[model samples]
Target: MKAQFPIFDICKLSRCEQEDIFISRLAPFLDKHQNLLLSHKHTFYHIVLFTEGAGSHDIDFQRFLVRPYQIYFMGPGQVHSWSFEGKVDGYVVNFSTQFFQSLLLKADYLDQFPFFNGNVAEAVIDLSTNLHPLILDLFEKLVHESETVQHLRQDMVRVLLVQLFIQMDRLSFERPVHQATAYNYTLLRNYQKLVEKNYTSLKLPREYAELLFITPGHLNALCHEVLGQSAGEVIRDRIMLEAKRLLTNLSLTISEVAYQLNFADNSYFTKFFKKHTGLTPEKFRDGLFNQLSQDALSLQ
Candidate 1:
């Protein structure tokens, strides 16, 4: 498929060469990159530990209201944006998959964290006041080590990230509602990974079920049981997500977006998008531009 949602390169966005990990304060980062921050997907993992903020963050169309002492996580390719009423005080961490591979041999090291599971569950964690200091300290150390040129700085960054991940994982399990049977969780995780990799080419739920060696009905059942949605919803949501991302790029025309997504024609794409999102492509793009204009005016 053609480019979906303008995949941002970590090094280019950070303006640093050969750096896989990017960390900075949320307010300043948002200030500098406000134009690109809204309505685009990143090629790197996004972690933001918010110390003070009241906002609403959107991840793949799922909305979560943000509060202080909470952390938000978004895996690569997930679209996210934030709207806040007041200043946001926190640390933003962006790291590529390469950063993980450099430290560990396992390909699934990042998958161990529940927040990165691609499913809609536990993407945001509300931290206890007692744990705030520990989390803040870890982020501060990472920022310092990232700026300082020292022996094994990369190694040190990786260690700090692993530590942060471990802490978050521990807290994830403390919430009983986030737990799932191992078998079902594994099935969903595998399905999500396949969807992430092949959503553009393989659009059918049965295709994913076939690849997973399961019946389509069984897959749907598992999805409904685990995620409160059907297998078809999951697949369609992924497709529509890319559609929204492509729509965000004003450079691409409606027909071009449809063609890149492999839709038979513009009409079919508009029908599909409207059925899911309740808005045609043109309307959605227009609404986005209108909202952006209003935000800019507010700044003025």
Candidate 2:
């Protein structure tokens, strides 16, 4: 039998009675869990802010250079690993999926934040010099609240998190272009959510269009206008991303991966994977292992 990839939960990482959330300073957290340097998946949402640090962290196979005043967010089930060049310190919070459901009126309130939408590109943020004090203050309060047994401590933490998210979202808007109107943006986001939920079984833009009550042409045009990709390309990209993620697990063979992705056979899967990624599934897996081995050796 092959070894399964590690998946950690907030309950296992914290001793709090609720076990729904865990918060700590980054340096101590790293000292306690050095194994985090290796790739692992988390069952809880993760937020980290680097007050001081220098290193690289990988999220879903995408590597990002670490810097001071940088914050990153990861939703459940995303694979991540870290490597630090020197002393690293920050604030880290891990919370369950249901952490805010009871406190907030909207069950999907967290999804409104772009960082939590599973787009790695938008998830890691670098704060401007002027915004540094504000961001730092919020994190400091969060740490203090987590350490104290005060009235409505959890509620306070939730409020702080929402404030932090709103601040970041506001910063994101300062970018040069905001093409989609409010109605179109909501529609596009909803379409993306559907694709994420049904990517494995539904492999066409038309299928997703029907679910969204929009014509396939409108869907394709919206994707191209906002995302610079066709609707079909978006679906294909999601399927390809899942394929890459599943391939990372050494326990599963290529054929097994195909079956899980709803492909009829391994051959077609190989063709599709290679055509999109320029590497066969076997080669991709082999290269991934080799790269990991190199990373381990470098650390040693």
Candidate 3:
């Protein structure tokens, strides 16, 4: 059977102009608990700002806790899930890659910040006592402006984000050279985000180069310089992750999964899946189910 990737909930996407948009979803998991049971791999990447509540988040195979005043940046293709302790209060800021445009964080530099990576992961942050007030202040202004001065919310959100980004970038353990590449980082970021969203649909580096007005070779150079992987690698990685999601998550037959991912036939899907994970469709499915059953029995 072919594989299909999970779909995201982000309905619209604006260009990389302005700062960002804010929708204060203060309601957490209670009666309002709308858990996104992705029966498949998730597609639209987004972020989470925890205002209040305790929860555990699982990204791919990693697990972490979510605390208050913490922010996480997630990208388009990451397989993630979360469970809140009773009422989980937070803001689900589902922004497009266009908004995250590689300006602030390069794809390579962002490897540690899984929240921002397109593969989909939730990061947790619990700022020290000295920095708590700063985040609180920003959150207050964001909520206040959201209610009162609705006009200036976008700019305020930008400032708040810049604060968090700066702090997180500082706390990162990367060397000074890696941290100092903030210059024109957003341009690279925009390019990266563009590719993450459209790489599957838009083939060829030149296609992306055309959109960015740069040559394909130059774009490839930049990708390798920053991401340590070729542009094609990044694209293929996203597609492969999506394919895995479809093959493993949903119970759809291989043919359906293949068509959803735009593959021409089951043979192509099998070849692609086998290329990434040396196992054929039947073997992969059997292994996944076997693992799940073992986990279930262990819990029992």
Best by TM-score: 2
Worst 10-residue lDDT window for candidate 2 reads 1-10
For candidate 1, report its TM-score. 0.84
lDDT of 2: 0.86
Name every residue pair that clashes in candidate 2.
Answer: none
Model 2 scores a TM of: 0.92
Q: Give the CA lDDT, 0 to 100, for residue 108 in model 1.
A: 86
Error of 3 at 261 (Å): 2.8
Residue 171 in model 1: lDDT:
86
Tens digits of per-residue lDDT for model 1 on 1-300? 222345686887788765688888878888888755455678889899887878688887678888988888888877776788788878889988788786699988888677887765578888998898999999999889977899999899889989999999888767764467778778888898898788878988999999999999999988887778898888887788788777878789999999988889999999999998889999988877676566555655
**What's the true lDDT of residue 150 in model 3?**
69
Candidate 2 residue-wise lDDT, 12-76, digit = tens: 67755558888899999999887678777899999999988797999988999999999999999
Off by over 4 Å in 1: 1-14, 27-41, 117-121, 174-178
Per-prediction backbone clash count: 0, 0, 19
Candidate 2 wrong stretches, greater than 4 Å: 1-4, 15-18, 294-300
RMSD of each: 3.6, 2.1, 8.0
